[model samples]
Target: MRRIAVLLPLLAIGVLAGCGGSSSSTAKPVVKVSGAFGQPPTIKIPAEKAGGSLTVKTLIHGTGPVLQRTDAFVGNYAIYIWSGTSHRLAQSSFTAHRPTLFAGQLLPGLETALIGQKMGSRVLAVIPPKDGFGTSGNPQAGVKPTDTLVFVVDMMKDFKANASATGTAESNGGKGLPTVTAVNGAAPTIKMPTSKPPATLVTRTLIKGSGPAVTKGQMVVAQYVGAIWSTGKVFDASWNRHQPFNFTIGATPTQVIAGWDKGLLGQTVGSRVMLVVPPADGYGKSGSPQAGIKGTDTLVFVVDVLGAFST
Candidate 1:
């Protein structure tokens, strides 16, 4: 989970009631949140004692799908701890210009606040110590045992584990590129070209998605198959695991290989893109022996962008 800038350790939470209503039967604080959906919010915390129970308020209702605890989602958040008159900021995916992947990896309180909520909504939750770090306050984030945690979240996108790409198919312009065979929403098989591989990185879109264009510092969920160009052997395939792959698209040293960072940028969500990666953008001189990749082997990947989420 890489922490992903959270108030507590990255983890999952349990499910709650249905969406479209605030939680009752709990004594909550008076926290004000003002912001548009999908944008950074201005949260005003009361300079008073903590709340007695978990409290959830939906600032802006969304028209998207209702989220479930089993589903994976992406959203931007701002966290703070309230103790007496001192309110301090802990972490914010909004400030980082990136969204966190809420794949059941989050604090229990925060997770409970999100489940059953609709995508594209703005939620404010005030969690007491019971649902937060409990009796042992999180010293790493400077929280006291009695301190209450406040979270402002902007829900962006949600997807099931088996979600696939949906877009308009386009001609692959098959000139010097490998042939891809995709059927029945399964993994696409790649047949290498007889000619030599390209010396540099090459990206071709087999499907042009109408969704938002993928940008840097965004979490991208996709289904992909990676093969060595020369032997045409599949080194990796997300479809085989029956789960989509997710990573933060960024510079080479960050979440994924350099080839993915460069080739996937600006690609629209739901597009099936083919990437021809040279050695420099791959594992470099020290190839991945475990994956049977050599230093000079050019790699080929067929990627289906399922979704993209940003701050």
Candidate 2:
């Protein structure tokens, strides 16, 4: 067993009692695991389950860097629900098509379970409704409001953001798309596109990098600033938060705009690129007003590709 320098709240308090009025001592080893890492485990559930809090048990220990709560830790997971009798495997992220999940991206309970665990570690956890799909369980996954969820997760890698946006600074003519300028390693400021938005995608690599080129189906860790082409109003920026934003490019149930898929497909990591996305490739007819974009607004983005992970 490897030593864990950082421990989550669950590890310290152990199993909590709740759900029904029964005490947790009645549900020892709420989630039973009898399988090797990287493969589906034989999970067994107790007749009595926990509900008040989360129960996490480390199955395989890892002797690597301890992960932070907000780190974009790439992982694979399989989730199941305790259906009255047996544990029915619901969803599995253990395939080659697993996505890297972050804080605001996963269930609050799962985050608590993964935090403090080092990279390459595997753990099993039982989550109650309070920390899971609340009173109204996710009907899509056949999860009942009162169902207890179990997960087998494998923390794979810890990704780090790049420092300065490095790459070959190129020009896109004097008045074509948009103009981007950065100083002293600061975030690039854009002078929004003056001409009408192009019908096709307009991608310009402001900086050419020496790192690996981003490929389709790879998750990109990056810092970016987005704006509306109509008014040049900055919609969102990752640099302002001093944190990097990440998403799978060209992935199933795409997490980012189509502009990113087309613009960043062949770009190199560590390079800053600008994308001019028309309505067809953006939020489309139903624009994101919360993002300050109109139905017909053309979106612009200055993305700093920090890293790419696949597997």
Candidate 3:
């Protein structure tokens, strides 16, 4: 068995709070596996006669309350790549505490597994190629497209509605612009007027792309550029790097500040947006060490929509 380093320290501990529940001595039987790529998993449970095959597996069991769509969750999990003869390409662990069913937070298979699970439940899910990293595979993940992925997940706490109630009226503070138009069952389109320059020079559309419409839980990929609205000075941009930063949207309140969330919500694929964020919305009080963004700086971004995934 090839053992990759399991970086547990990188895992989010706070997310695993309610996962340490009592374990049931009785073991659930693992029977024949039936299913093809691009299809849901199937497991036969002997405990209940009416039990149908489970699309995913709950390896570690928890004894906490069940979860609902309105609830949010925090968790720690390990992902491993599985070869035919028990060899694993790589493994890593991380923490995620966010609205469980929200789009753009998790992989397709893991998101599907989490939908009906409750707090304190431990899940061990076997993900096939199509459901995991697709054809190109995750080179950094060390798993090939042909590899099967296994995830051991521990659901910590499920916070009920209004759990982390931000007193503000909108989800984030009422900072972001209101929806100008809604994309109704069509590919998102941006109509930038050629004749006139946008009212603001610095603008961005943080998330973009087409797959499934982004909700709140799944991960989002985007391209971004930052500049000053006044002088058009380019401050920061991901265009040169040619790689989008991968962050699970809404998973960590601290990963991104309030302004970003407010800016991104309800944005559809292929949307282009401009933001003129005040110092309070950009960098408040303390500027970033590396970026040289000042405490009093009002930032602007030009964001391009790339793609979204919901599993």
Candidate 4:
């Protein structure tokens, strides 16, 4: 794990503050960042130390949605610790081949730099101690209380908690599967029948999306509801939490259940899919007792594919 990942946790939430000092007399720091959007940037720190305040510079302007305090976004970013005459690279989501989710509260300087920026823009932020990890610094990340931090962020995609599938409905022909009632921008309702659940896995597309088909090894954002077929009781739902689930599809060792890996592949973004998962592809014979699922019970799920990003 990257050192910053250990300290920041990516989706941290906290107070929001604007870039730069509160006083007009404060001068903007001279930090140079040069690179193409979507690639790692080359940063050159000034020989002189920066002012005792946050500084923000937009390296590239994007035309996408303007981000808000409560909005969420995917970004390819790199962090460097600037120690006056020298700097050290701390972390880079671009190098890891995975974009990061920036939402809720972040490092005050980071949030300030990103909040008003447009999606697809590249932003650079120089964060002083007060706007970063505070006076305690992040010793584990080699950051001293006196050191300033630099961030280069490439905003890739923006999304909201209520994001859902958008596409034309496809008829299922009443194939004896569970029925699903989905409304755009709202949580879906699913009803199961008393008939015996399918013994094998069943993948059905309830809505055909216009976006690209999902590929293996891509970061996927989705909203879903899972229920036991036998009892028709809801066991889990991302909608209830008001946050979409993010996972790397087909990642080694797996980031989700086997059924999800099998069912989501090839599904297009914005499509709503239904998967009837048998034990072998689900929680297996052990089942998920905490979720009210039995050893032999089958699982039914309706999932909305919100977004997909290549690693």
On TM-score, the leading prediction is 4
Better lDDT candidate (3, 4): 4
TM-scores for all predictions: 0.76, 0.69, 0.40, 0.85
Tens digit of lDDT per residue, candidate 1, span 167-229? 888855367889887774778879888999989999989888999999997778888889999
Candidate 1 C-alpha error for residue 131, in Å: 2.2
Residues 1-311, model 2: lDDT tens digits: 00112222222112222223211222354566787766656677676644455778788998878987555656667777875555666666555465444423456566667778987788887777766666766665577787777888877766543245666666632377778877735677888656787877788877777889888888777888888888888878876765577677776667677778878898898788888888888878888877777879888888888778774
| Pairs in steric clash, model 2 | 167-207, 167-208, 168-207, 168-208
**Of 2 and 3, the candidate ranking higher by lDDT:** 2
* RMSD (CA, Å), each prediction: 5.2, 8.3, 14.7, 4.2
Candidate 2 stretches greater than 4 Å from native: 1-27, 30-53, 105-108, 129-140, 159-177, 181-187, 193-200, 207-211, 238-248, 251-256, 279-297
**Where does model 3 exceed 4 Å of error?**
1-34, 38-213
Predict model 2's lDDT versus the native.
0.68
User: Largest lDDT belongs to which candidate?
Assistant: 4
Residues 140-200 of candidate 4 have per-residue lDDT tens digits of: 5677888888888999888887889888899542468999986778888888876798889
